[model samples]
Target: MYVAVKGGEKAIDAAHAWLAEERRGDTSVAELSIAQIREQLALAVNRVMAEGSLYDPDLAALAIKQARGDLIEAIFLIRAYRTTLPRFGATLPVETAEMACDRRISATFKDAPGGQVLGPTFDYTHRLLDFKLAAEGEAPVAPTREASQEATPHITTFLKQEGVIQTEVDQGDTPRDLTREPLELPADRALRLQSLTRGDEGFVLGMAYSTQRGYARNHAFVGELRIGTCAVEMEIPELGFAIEVGELELTECETVNQFTGSKTEPPQFTRGYGLVFGQSERKSISMALVDRALRWEELGEDNMGAPARDAEFVLYHADNIQATGFLEHIKLPHYVDFQSELELVRKLRAEAEENLASAAANTVPEAAE
Candidate 1:
């Protein structure tokens, strides 16, 4: 058993007390409610849910509160909690085609079948601070237009019809889950997408940016970006039929990238797909960019020694919890290793001084002679 040092228990208790006090800065000030975080800070909650791989908004809000608004910490908490829960069964893949879209947009065509619907985005908003929101008074609800009922078709369908883009093929194989199995090199598309979905958003964004800055540049264009609720279905073997299990909000991005045909194939466009939980468009888009870059092998493109193209490098470092744990562990006791290093440095210095003294002694005797 690992033994605690002297006063370790007392120090831990004191540290916890200090942390609690710090969490609540002033008694006079109203405590930030979980409901406020769930509703007002919905974006943060959505991100936590996305990265944590758990879709419970209330629990995510609670985790956020417990973490004192540290999003990565909240995600870690949720992920830890999620591991304890018993799994019932796996649900069938949700269909994006039947999505009840709140926001749908395409960049390839200005006037596509389903016109670009900018639902609730900060895209066109000015970055000016709204100081009025600082007051506690509630603001009036803004009226919203009725959402279109027409089923929105994917923008890539147009290219597929003309044989300009590669048609999506189903290999009919269960994707290897990174959470359950060790990550293998040269990961398949499904495994790669899974990693990117749960990857650290900032790291994925950086990798994507590198690709755009001429590191295995793929000339990617946002073919379509859709945010909506999709129904999850599960096939019950006993019943011999599928039933709707639940609905979940998803943000899906499809990037159409430039592709030159191989010897056996004709010139066509390839695609990179990203689907993340909730309204995480930035993460989804970044996932798509990285996804495309990692496809250099299948696409017959040269490995330009790009960071994004290195599947092993990207997947290994994209996990925040793992990164944080390893990074923060440096604070723990390293006395033995540190002492060894210190001794080595001292020995090197002593050896240098002794050599210098011997050299001086020899030179003085020669000069005297």
Candidate 2:
């Protein structure tokens, strides 16, 4: 029979009280509201929603507050809460062509149909800190222009028409949901993208960076990267038609990689794709690179033993919740294991000394004889 340690409830309660105090340091300062967090820390809220697989900004803000600004903890909270809600039906595939794009850029083309709209970006800004913002100085209004209403054609489509890029043949198959099912090896492109979308932003970024450093170099160029809102629609069984459920912000990245033609095919530019919830451009870009790296078999490219090329490794280590749980569990009581190890070491040392002493005694006797 084994007896476990107790007082978890009492310790947890006290810890919670201490945490609340720490969260609101300096009583004279005003307490932050969920609304303020939603509005002021919009980027943080967006990240939580993106990684959590939940799009509710309000709930994400609340989770952030409850977690005391730990983004991973907030994401875990959102994911846990999301699992409890009853799933009715899935929406149809979102149409990016009809997206109300706010920010769109293409590196492959000098100019695209809608042109490069660098909306709300930190690009070209100096990294020097402005001390004027310390006093909450008023900022100048940003210049704006009316956006074009024309449907933005994908940059890859242009290459496809020119016969310079490989056309992806759509194999009509329902994509597996990672949220509902256990991740299996040799995942399809859809499953790999899903994992990458919900994967840790830093981890994915590192993996992508490693590829550039020659782990599995795929000469990649950003074909197109767009950030905007797309309408979601779901088919109603009774109504016999699809209706607009809601609109969500999305960041989509498409990478054009140079693929040397195999025996069966001609040389062409292949593609790697990423679509993530909210304006997570960095994550989306990294996802595309990692996605292409993992598709070695499909692309007829050498694996080159890259970490990012391993689907099993990337998917398994992607989840922050799983990583945190396994990592943090090491802090738990290991007295029994430690004691067993201690005893074994002591026994080994004692046996070694006894053997040495016996050998010395036998040597002395032999010499005297």
Candidate 3:
């Protein structure tokens, strides 16, 4: 029961004013700029872009600043803002093979076609924090290298060539956009990938972790993980040709899972693919694992009754925006509904007490006799 409470316009306005004041903080302290957030807090901006399904780093940074460093709140702001934008035509699919990779690594092989290029990553850094960063001195410049023009072939291609991995078949159908259309159950790989890419990082990570803990345990090896910039092309109606619209920073992950074979079919490795906006390696890897787990039916494997294996459960609960909305609705004025539940509980307790008293009285009379 949603009872409309009236007459708090002034209070609401004052509260918003106070919030703005608090967001500004002390007068003596220097205010943070949007550029500072965009550059320094790049990871947060990337997360907001990935989950919000928007690729604008500037807008993401602005949202972060507006949200006072709360990432989920920032994502919420980005998502709300995304609704007002006009729909443009879809771009051509990005080619990861021709990506100008900043970082590329394969755990499955000792070395791959492109070789390992470990770019701006904290993988090798010590966990200890450097207090020198607090003093705000000039930071040491990182060594630069000439950008490689060579194409980095996908690691899964090698396995596929060896006839060890299952090959993917392109249906040449347009993928359904959940943003434009409502998500129906029994979603295809394309729809599932879309959901996972835009899904809550934490939720998806948890689901992926669940699979690793023997819940539909598929032995997955990271075939390749690449982060780089790729050109985006868009088709022009007048020219009848696609033109390069922009470039996007993306992280792509490919996982080679355990081989599946039967009496008739030969053993072949199954593959899981993940691609997301910006340099979101963790999210991409998690997406791959969950993607593989969800493919139990398609892969002709037995359903292990795992939450990750349940497409409906995973897809429905994966979105943080939807989950947050449903969860936060309880915080709103539910006075009528709560009061009804409270009254019912009290009535049941009172009835039980009355029954107990009646039984006690009957027992006392019997004892007296």
Candidate 4:
């Protein structure tokens, strides 16, 4: 007779209280405010917003704090919260070029129309730990970069002038959201990028690094990496016009990759694109590289069967939230299945032992006879 396990209600309540305590940590230490998390842990908040597909920095920060700095948990919280939030309407395509540039730069050109403004990058900073920061010392003043009136056009656009790079038609179409929909194989550019943005940063970086190191050698140049706030516009049919809804921080990366001429087409340099939430340059760059690698088949290139080249491989495995949730869920109870397996093994062993004994007895009797 099997008895159903009870005490889940009490266990759950107790766990909730204990989790609250754990999240709070030391009783004497001052509790972390959502604002403090939002301001102090801005980058974490940014990553959560980007990956979570939610735009609210404050809520992301709060989730981070609530999750005790577990970024994946924070992302999960943001995703869950976003589901309940009322959707006013879909926003028009964000003009990233027209963004209020916080950080903008071009590697392809020495000087672009919008001159390279290396804004808020850790690129040149020494990797040494500061003793003063250990005690929460005052931060250095923000350095001002002079803004340029002449808008710099995208480097890829310039390459397209001579028919060097693949020209993309601005579908100006609606892009898909991977968070809301289940990811299917053979994804479009928009869907692939969405998966990569919320993807395991380390995994994406390694795959991108692999392409650079010759797993699928696609020579790529970083045409541009831009980070800034862009206004989100939404059209209201009732009002008969699109209005500025709000602004969001975006990190956009454009890469130029080498491509061979197709049988029916002339040789051309191909373009790979990546756009992420917050200032996720690493993710964006990695995404661009992977994006280029995936397009090899479409461009009529040879099949190298690289990790990045496999759409089913990259898209299916990139999501850390899904990976971790499934991986970590094994810790939950499955004793019934375990016991069943144990019983089957025991039964099999007993039958094998009986057979062996019978064979031995028969052999001994035959020899005696």
Candidate 2 least-lDDT 10 residues? 142-151
How far off is residue 127 in model 2, in Å?
0.9
RMSD of 2: 2.7
Name the best candidate (by TM-score).
3
lDDT per residue, candidate 4, 107-212, as tens digits?
Answer: 8888776677888889998989879998998899986665443344677777888888887787877877676789987788888878888887888888899999
If both were scored by lDDT, which would come out higher, candidate 1 or candidate 3? 3
* Candidate 3, poorest ten consecutive residues by summed lDDT: 258-267
Candidate 1's displacement at residue 114, Å, is 1.8
Rank ordering of all candidates by TM-score, starting from the highest: 3, 1, 2, 4
Give the per-residue lDDT of model 2 (tens digit) for 246-265: 99989999999998887666
RMSD of each: 2.7, 2.7, 2.3, 2.9
Worst 10 residues of 4 by lDDT: 144-153
Find the number of clashing residue pairs for candidate 4. Answer: 2
Clashing pairs in 3: none
Residue 109 deviation, candidate 3, in Å?
1.4
- Residue 248 CA displacement from its true place in model 2, Å: 0.6
How does model 1 fare in lDDT? Answer: 0.88
Evaluate model 4: give its TM-score: 0.91
TM-score of candidate 1 relative to the true fold = 0.94
Residue lDDT tens for model 3, 1-369: 446678679878988999999999997999999999999999999999999989999999999999989888889999899999998788988888999998999998886887998898889999898999999888898898755667889999888889898888898899999887878988999999999999999999999999999999878999999999899999999999999999999999999988667544468888888899898999999999999999888667778799999999999999998999999998878788888998899999999999999998888444665
